[model samples]
Target: MSDYIVEFNNVTKEYVRQVALQNISLKLPRGKLIGLVGPNGSGKSTILKLIAGLVRPSRGSVRVNGRQANRMLASEISYLSELDVLYPFYTVAETIDFNAGLFRNFDMAKAREMMSFMQLDPGKKVKDLSKGNRGRLKIILSLARQVPLILMDEPLSGLDPLVRDSIIQSLISYLDLEQQTVIMTTHEVTEVEPILDTVVAIQNGQLRGMAEVEEIRMTHGQSLVEWMKHNLA
Candidate 1:
């Protein structure tokens, strides 16, 4: 079995004429929280989409759990999209049921726990949810699965500071890092710095650097936020 939960080998992604990622090669170690950090349009989300198999690379390969990314791999991976994936008409209960029916690894009890933790009403429809709640719902849905890998795009985006902090704390407490590898894309370097084990910095579709949080602090003598700014500057 591959030691890495996810791997990108010389990957390139394009949208029509625009190159989103180019000649990217990286491997994410199993069972850790990894932050993909960069500015807007820096290929951070593209990398997550590629690993989730939502998009195909124009070149090279994306592997999950030792297999090429595909529909089968979808069961082993959970993707929290930057955009809403929930149908507006679905009630919270129905939405959970719908997703629970799809992935065999899904745990309904865990889903309920997450909903309760997030203070989401089971009768509430997706359309009625606030931005923070919607984000929470997405996170709950993703974490409900007993998958080996998780990909999230901007998990902290457009949230109140208190709400963001709560979500982060819940993630740290709820996630079993020994069994799951979470790779998330975000611009909130400072907010996520505390939770991340590794940081992958990208700019203009190329890697700026990849380092452990400790490495940044010990070797570089800078916080992840400061190191990111300095590296990307």
Candidate 2:
């Protein structure tokens, strides 16, 4: 068995005239919380889509768990997009039940626990919830699943710092790092920095650098944001 859960072998993803990812290659190890950090339009989401089998690479190969990435990997991956995909007509509890029905590995106990942890009102309609609460629910939906890979795109987009803090705590508490690998893309670098084991920096549809989170602080005396700035410069 290989150590990597995801392998991108010189992958390139192009759409129309725009190239999202250009000849990128990296091996993402198993059982770690990784942050895919980059500026907007820097291909962060593209990477997650490829991993989730929502999109294919225009060139090279994308493999998840040694198999070619495809819709069949749905059982292996849980993807949370930046956009709102929740059924607004359903109540919070109903939405949880809906997701529980879709996947056998969906942990109902964990989902309820996270709903409570997120302070989401079960009886309230999804449309009635605040944006922050909706974001919390999205996190719960993705994290409650017992899967090898969790892909989150801009998970902390609109929330205030305090809410982000709680969400980050839940991310640490709920995940089993021995079994799961979380790849999250977020603009809130400073906020999510504490939970990340590794950081992969991408810019202008190309790989800029990759580094361990602790190494940057101990060796370079820099935060993830500072490291990104230096690399992107």
Candidate 3:
């Protein structure tokens, strides 16, 4: 078995006239909570999409579990997009049931447990749920999956501090780090600093640096935010 769960080797991605990602290479270890932080349009989302195999790379390769990334690799990953794609007409319970039917790895028991933990109303339609509740539901859907990798794009975006705190707490409470690896992109640096095992900094479509969260504090006498500022500058 490979030590890394995901690897991007000299990869580049372009869209029409814009370069989304430059020559980039990365190796993400298994069973880690990795934070990807960068300015807006810094190729963070593109990196996640490439890992999910939602788009083909323009150069080099992306690999998951030592195999080249492709659409078929979707089975090994659960992606939480920044955009909300839930069915507004479906009640909370129905949405869970639908996903349970769709994904072979969907853990129905885990979904139910998370639902109760998030205090979501089973009978409430998705449209009626507040944005915070909706966000919670989205998280439950992603985390309940039994896939080895989970990619979250701006999962904390637009959420109030309280909601973000709950979500972060839920992440710590539910994740079996021995069995799953998570890569999350967020602008909430300080909020997520406590739970992150590693932090990767990206800028202008290029990887700036990657470091262990504890290493930053212990060795450099700096927080992730300080490290990110120095690297991204």
Question: Ten-residue segment with the worst summed lDDT in candidate 3?
Answer: 68-77
CA lDDT of every candidate: 0.89, 0.94, 0.95
Clashes of each: 0, 0, 0
Candidate with the larger TM-score of 1 and 3: 3
The best-first sequence of candidates by lDDT reads 3, 2, 1
Compose the digit string of candidate 2's lDDT tens values, residues 74-149: 9989999999999999999999999999999999999999999888999999999999999999999999999999
Model 1 sits at a Cα RMSD from the real structure of 1.2
Q: Give the alpha carbon lDDT tens digit for every residue of 101-128 in model 1.
A: 9888999999998899888999999999
Off by over 4 Å in 3: none
TM-score of each: 0.96, 0.99, 0.99
